[model samples]
Target: MRKHTGKSVSRRLVLKAAAVGGTALAMPAIVSRSVLASSGEINIMMWSDYLPDPFRDAFTKKTGIKINFTGIGSNDDILNKMKATNGQGFDLISPTLNRSLLWEPLGLIQPFDMKKIPIDKVNPAMAKMGETVWNFGGKGVAWVPHIWGTEGVSWRTDKFKPAGEFPSYGDIWDDANAGKTMGRGHSVMLGAGLALERKGEMAPGSMWAAYQSPEKMTEVWSKLTEYCIGKKKNLKLLWNDADTQKNGLLNEGVIVAQTWDGPPIALKTAGEPVMYRAPVEGAMAWVDGLALPVGVKNVDQVYAFIEACYDAALAGEAIKTHGYNSPVTGADKFAGDVYAKNFADAYPGDALAKLNPWPPEAPWYAEKRTEFVNKFMSA
Candidate 1:
């Protein structure tokens, strides 16, 4: 069994590399907790790997905060779980940075009490993302960075080669790779929109502009959905989480797929023939951050648990054992050198500049996009 490492590359290096890729990183959110953990109990709903068993156990022993944890797989899973309970069950919830905009309308989250958190230890850029993007009503913050990564292309090295100077999202739909590729449903649609935009089929910036309004989203997505439907034969299967991605490339005969950076990189580090990389159109970068559910019951305990999460050393140690990139400053020093190398290997020359940060979306647009995804999946 292989474990994913975290905070491996310094944020400065990553931000610089992204600069070289010809794009800027913004609107990202991902964070963790602190070492001055108060004693108590807290319920956590986050990605399964976010709290590796070792970290959870160590946190339990050190802080004496008996944690009741429920791990979720995707932002959709996070949304559904919160909605299913009306935000009453979990104390700490993790959702991707780009997805933060949807929570306010659902009335599911409360603004994070920054004074209760160790915000000073977090990565400056990630903290700014939360401060600006997660601020609801211009007064309170609703999310903080925990873990950040990207969604991009991966391939079976023995089976395929990029057609140009760099891999583009377009490669996923090319006839040659058809029947051998995969992607998450909604993101693949976004990738399609991007490819279409580049080909002059859709207006420039149409993909990001779809986030602004339902009318715009509908117009942009309509074309994207149709193009994706036409390319349906290209995918072997659409993966929803890390396991499916690994299995698709490792066992299900998939040669290429749009994937979170972690999965394929994990495989490659383990000596598999797979390779993951940023695409020419850009690697979709995002951060999964911690948020407070509105009805959080154990308020004090929640703060304690949150503070424990921000402890840079613990966060870095967790990364050494799981698949995540921390937003906690000083955590990278603990993730070992391999992660930095992996970062370099994946972004190879200007791939970082191509980072296509996932833009914020309206709750309505999110719902509408889900419908489009379902339509494409069923078509």
Candidate 2:
């Protein structure tokens, strides 16, 4: 009944983890003057509404430190700026789970002191994310798990018809659905790779590692090439953000499209004909965690900031406000029934009942993304 509405945020795709240069480095200088140049002020880079007034107000009230926050475009942007500063200015950075693998090794990150964090306050699920994304094999020990969510089919019910068996990634290739479906760019390509996995064709250590083999890679590539290049004409829309995916379905650009849970959940609450459906085969899931950049001067301040957010009460509020799943396990007890019902709609009933959290596995992505891009995108 209560729908979430806010301005659409820019989606940043990190093509590569390149060092910042003249213009890139200068951008943060401008932000510093406008945001964190005051005494006892800390600048934070994160997604919009991720840290609401409650948390900031609570933190400031509790710690006597001013919170100066800036909404960044993407994880890559966050990393680029932190790298440029050599981890000098910004106190905290929130980046996607997989991408953290890249940042951790660059000396951009360092481990946080567990003594500062009340381990009991954190949700077990989030702790797992922290271990996998930021602390992958003790690589970048500085980051902590924040809010997390996934990519899947967020559809407009009035415009599109989903039948008996819920659609899977393989459905994207169906000719009958041509020009009536949309897909997310970059990240959803990982979903496309998963589709390849469903067909028993994919390589080891690829995005489809859950369903791949070294022997089947060649056959998988041949098949994937046909779908992406040969069937490119059938795609009604290729979107990069949640707004575009929702708009495409509403505007008739596509009937069913891959999306995160937020947009469709918003539309449904507004009494619009829309739904968020995660495929039966499994959806491409992503998790994001908060990390302290290496070389932070105010390590105690950073720890205090993380500790405040780690409080289950604040984390629950963030999960509700953002419409993303909380990696914090017990936070669910604080959520409304509508949030649970709506969130559950995205998954198949059976699978939803026993959801298996997606693991943060980077070596799999690093090794395989190139071949997939070359075979699917190029073709």
Can you write out model 2's per-residue Cα lDDT over 171-200, one digit (the tens) per residue? Answer: 665577788877754455656667666666
- Residues 1-379, candidate 1, lDDT per residue (tens digit)? 1222332343565543322220121111332333334567788888766676777676676656788988776888989888998988888898887776677678888887788788898877778777877787786888887887788889999998887756778888888888888889888878877877788888989988888889988888888888899989988888887888899999999998888888887788677998888887777877888889988987877776666567777676666555457777777675657666666667777766567777776779878988998999999
Per-model lDDT: 0.76, 0.58
RMSD of 1: 6.4
Worst ten-residue run, lDDT, model 1?
A: 19-28
- lDDT of model 1 at position 283: 78
TM-score of 1: 0.86
Name the lDDT value of residue 219 in candidate 2. 51
Least accurate 10 contiguous residues by lDDT in model 2: 14-23
Model 2, runs deviating above 4 Å? 1-39, 52-67, 70-75, 80-85, 128-140, 196-207, 210-222, 249-252, 295-301, 353-379
